[model samples]
Target: MLHLHILSWILAIILFFAAYQNFSDRQGPSQYFKPLHMVLRVFLLLTLISGGVVFFQTMGGGMAAQYGIKFLLGLITIGLMEMTLAKKKKKKPSRTFFYLVIFFALLTIGMGIWLPMGPISAMFN
Candidate 1:
């Protein structure tokens, strides 16, 4: 589950940039991007679900603080992606929204690095 969560985060980052490029070109999301967008949405859902399961399953192991922060970052990352999609759907896509997605995705990915390593584990581990 942790591996899947990490994979989802990486894939979402790729999809976010791919979708962003279509908007960057002022062409909006084309057929290619549309599918990518949907896949990204699904992966984000998976990431959230898996994160929740892992957090709850291990919560009382003395790493609640780190897990809590990671969980919050994961939620915020999903929110940023949702905002990006919403803006694009409403025909109001902006660079700022795309940038937010990129920023949060990176943060989420960074924070999630420790998840599989046991809560507060270092990134290099």
Candidate 2:
């Protein structure tokens, strides 16, 4: 389940970059942008659901607070990604949102890796 959650978010990140590239085309948003964006949303949904499952399963442990913080950061990262893309599509200023997405995504990823339940930590153990 954790692996699935990780995979989904990684795919979501890739799809985000792909969609962003399509949006940055010289001719403006490419035809692929809509489809890519929709798929990205689906992956994000999967990520959320899987994260929820993991969160609940990890309850009764002392790490609940860390998990909660990671979950909230993940949500913020997703929200920022959506805002950045939407603002870009609408020709609005989105540079701040874009940077926020990057920052939050990295922060969330660091939290995930630092957590005891993830593959990275498991490997080290």
Candidate 3:
């Protein structure tokens, strides 16, 4: 379950960057990026659900600081991604918004990798 959660989110993050790059290169998101966007959304859903499962199953009743921080950051990351995509769709892409996405993504990914001391981080540490 943890592996699924991590894999899904990592894939989602990669897709997000691809789509964001496409948006940055073009004035707006084209049909080319539409499929990627949809897939990205699906991956995001999977990520959230899996994360929830892991949280409930492993974390028990306590919400540790790392857990809360990761959860909040995950939501913020989703919001930023959606906002950036929406803005691109509306033909009013905000560079600042995308920049925020980049920042949050890097931080969230770092925390995700660093906070987990189980199998997820075992490979690295």
Instruction: State every prediction's TM-score relative to the real structure.
Output: 0.79, 0.94, 0.81
| Runs in model 2 lying further than 4 Å from the true structure | none
Find the candidate with the highest TM-score and give its number. 2
| TM-score: the better of candidates 2 and 3 | 2
Model 3, residue 79: distance off in Å is: 1.1
lDDT of 3 by residue, 37-123 (tens): 999999999999988887667565454678778878888988998898888777784678889988998887788777754456778
State candidate 1's TM-score. Answer: 0.79
Better of 1 and 2 by TM-score: 2
**Candidate 1 lDDT score at position 86:** 71
lDDT of 1 at 95: 62
Error of 1 at 68 (Å): 1.1
Q: What is the per-residue lDDT of model 1 for residues 1-112, given as tens digits with 9 covering 90 to 100? A: 7677667777777777776565533655577877878888887788788888878876877878878887897788788777877787678845687787678767766766
Model 2 residue 26 CA deviation in Å:
6.2
Give the alpha carbon lDDT tens digit for every residue of 7-65 in model 2: 99999999998988787624679889999999999999999999999988888799999
C-alpha RMSD of candidate 2: 1.3
